[model samples]
Target: MAKLLARAGVASRREVERMIAEGRVALDGVVLDTPATILQSLNGVTVDGEPVAAPAAARLFLYHKPPGLLVTERDPGGRKTIYDQLPDDLPRLVPVGRLDLNTEGLLLMTTDGELKRQLELPATGVERAYRARAYGPITQEQLEELIHGVEIEGIRYGSINANLERRTGANVWIEMILTEGKNREVRRVLEYLGLKVSRLIRTRYGPFLLGDLAVGEIGEVKQHDVVSFRKDPTRKGGGEAPKLVEKPRPQQRGMQQIPSAPKAPIPKPQPARRITKTSANRADKAAFAEPTRQAQPGRDPVVLTKATKVKRFYDAKPKAGTGAGTEPVAPRAIAPGQRPKVFSPELGRNVRAKPGRTATPTEAAERKPAKATPRTAGKARAAPSKPARVKIHKSRTRK
Candidate 1:
């Protein structure tokens, strides 16, 4: 066999197995039953009833994927896939790193399956940087612990560099850099420490950045840059064959070399105060005591009487100028024919008439109504004469 399918670039040794299972691939007018079943170059091979063509050269691109997109070839639940957001002009590409459905950031995609494998393998050691906003009280000490390592649900996670960027109220923002991409590692670690991850965004993946790349945008890495990245010493061998370094575990005090457990913190004793017998007796009496005065029948309630007295006391005096319970009194009304002893203006001023004072007949006669002026009298007489004359003239003219 010439490895005819592989020569045609239809798929790799692994994908051919999957294609055979799907029944879309056939050989010599018969569908292939298994990947191991090989044939000579003369055997007819077809995909979707059409002859397969050789694949073009591989290409790589950097995509800024927004949240709510699934990083999969197809989702069984009919969820929107990253493929749906890819431009129509783009070739079929596999994501180098996966961003969860709720995660948004830099995602690398490649047309060649071999390149995808190379980038995703642990050997890549590609450092992924993320900016995370967490809600809870986080201290610099906690961030330093993250740099060492953290155990989550019995799974031991490796060291990661985390820094506290800023704190606002109960929420904090942190910048984290990790080489190994674990599933929900950042979120899980923070949650284990009683913190809530409110937002997560990948700012950079290796050398590629998400800067200014709008959501759903796909950008191709320059050919020269791709070549340079492949040769980068930092990403050399694609995280494969990482050098192992032995870490010294803390020693135990016993003769045997047993792993020592963290020591339990020593608690400090609080101060004890001595209480006197008199003070205790007074407190007991106060707690059990009742009011000394008993209620009287037909009397206002004690609370009501107290409230009424307070209201009256406040109302009688000006709030600030006069002292309480010492307001000035207003004068009382006087009865008729009883002269007030002291005639204050507010009481009512009195004007007494002089004795034997009478007006004479001449004086009384002089107070007559003043006569109307000649102009006024003339106008009054002329008003009635004009109406009478007009009526008489009309009767004469008619006769």
Candidate 2:
């Protein structure tokens, strides 16, 4: 009966057993007293007065649980739980393992209670990895001793593979991998080592990682991957753990106690070689040193380098018009006593320049007739003059 309730996604076998002991599990309104009751199916079984639904195909999801959320479905103290953060569309699921209220990272959620038990069982030997940031002095040698396991305050912890990743002052980051995840195991172990854990984050579990999954985001595992992983979870082959990022050592005021890795002496960037006029001349001569080869009738033409093309462009003279094939304008010479003439855009013609002042560009102005004022009221008003008409000359045609 416990197994039936567990497989039906009601809860874990242990929890179901507890529910039966509490008389919450019933068969057609008659509360079942024993978890060992003979039952072929859950047809008439009901838990907490709700009819049990048939279990669906097993499904798995990877949820990046943020801190401050409990793993349980509900909390007695009204604290937020993982279910509150989960999407409403997700099916009834249970966590493979529990994370502390403040611990954050990769959390496996599954629909099958049986599968969850299989994963959470310490005998299955599925590894769980965590990165803990703790304060206190600890050495790699001390952490290495955990491989043989340890007993703290009468509670025994299984063999743990631990390594000191890096340190900052009195604080250090440690990476721990273990199979048996006892309640408050990580914090207790670190506390036994005289280290106060400031932050704890689970990085990997079994074959899943919390890789790049944002806080509170959930992702489903592929059906094929879940199937393959279930075949042989104890195998050392699983998801690759991300490299431990070493925290930058803070700059100290005095000589360092621990010697850091020897840094490669940065070769003083040699002052950039200055291009002298002599070197420029030599380069220009060398560029054209090859005899100019003429293209033969049947041979391929010479390809010009970018530099050569640019040189030719600058050396080319400006043309009078924008046409590509227009003839280049010849340089105009000025007489010794004559001032240079400048183009007056306002006048639409080239005008002689004054030696003292320069021409300032002005906009084209329209000419208006002069108006007679009161002082000139008695005087005859000038007649309005007509605009001058220019004659158009047409080209003569050959007759």
Candidate 3:
């Protein structure tokens, strides 16, 4: 089997093995049992009932990936993948490197698995250029020392080419070109230097620059360039070299011509009219037109006629001892000849006395006892009660 599929051009060799296990890959009507099984060509192998063709010639493309897209074939979380952003007409190509979900910028893609592996190898020494904005002061000395190398969390990274662009307030912008791209290397290194990377954008990968490519856009390298690049083993893959082609510069013209001033038209005079005495008198009369005929004083400013007042009926007051709030009070019904019962608002209704009986004012006043004041221990002891007497006379008679 070709290493192309194993190198991620199609799928990993392990995945191919699984496909074989699932009877998806057939060799002359026989399902392959193991990945160790080798083949000279795709001759008798078919996947999903479709014949596998020989790998196409190697091609490379520059892709501008926007943030929030993953560089994976399939995400278990159903995230949008780079394959989804690629054009439908694109041939099978794998990302030369990965950009984290939050990182966006230039990404290299290649159709040839061998070419992809060749470019991505650390031995290739391909330079990837990135612009990073960090939140902290980074002196030129520190930047220069970065080229010497920096150790982050016990991991040693090779020297990097770093240049300070500018510093505004607390943030500093830096342009970095690196040969080796470790996971979050730029961010981790800057953080070790007491700086936090606020934004990171990959502007170039090897000889290919992003160059105004809108996010999610892809552009292919000329076929001749691809062949030339492959032939030259010394070619640095990223944005380190440019072909000798004289780019035309825009031509400058002289200052714009001033426009001519427009001519102003002359005003014409009208004939004068003679004023008669009557006309003068008419003008004076019009100037003093009789003061607007004073509106005759209207019927004495309308006296609001008193409207027939409607009688408002209110609920009867609750009995005396009952609560004086809005809560309903039960009413007491008595026989016609019985004296009206005294109202007790606190009791929530009228209280009726028995026939031929009436509660005196003293009895009514004494119905409830007055609250007693707290007393001292000595005062409490002074109060005493009468004692009971024994009946000895009945016991003597019985004896």
**Candidate 2: tens digits of C-alpha lDDT, residues 1-399:** 887777777777788889999999999999989898988878888888989987766788888889999989788999999988777766778888899999999999888877787789999999999999999989999999999999998999999999999998889999999999899999999999999999999998887788887787788887766777788777654553332222234578886677788999988888889999999999999898987867786688677776545457667766557447877665788889898788987899999887775434442222334566565657886899977655555654332
Query: Arrange candidates by lDDT, highest first: which order?
Result: 2, 3, 1
* Poorest lDDT segment (10 consecutive residues) of candidate 2: 240-249
| TM-score for each of the candidates | 0.52, 0.55, 0.56
Candidate no. 3 TM-score: 0.56
Q: Give stretches of model 2 more than 4 Å off.
A: 12-33, 43-53, 236-399
Query: Backbone clash tally for model 2?
Result: 0
lDDT of each: 0.72, 0.84, 0.76
Clashing pairs in 2: none
Candidate achieving the largest lDDT: 2
Q: Give a tens-digit lDDT track for model 3, residues 180-293.
A: 878888888888888988788999776677887777677788777777766763565444222221223334688565689998888789788899999999999999997665
Q: Name the runs in model 3 displaced over 4 angstroms.
A: 6-9, 12-14, 233-399
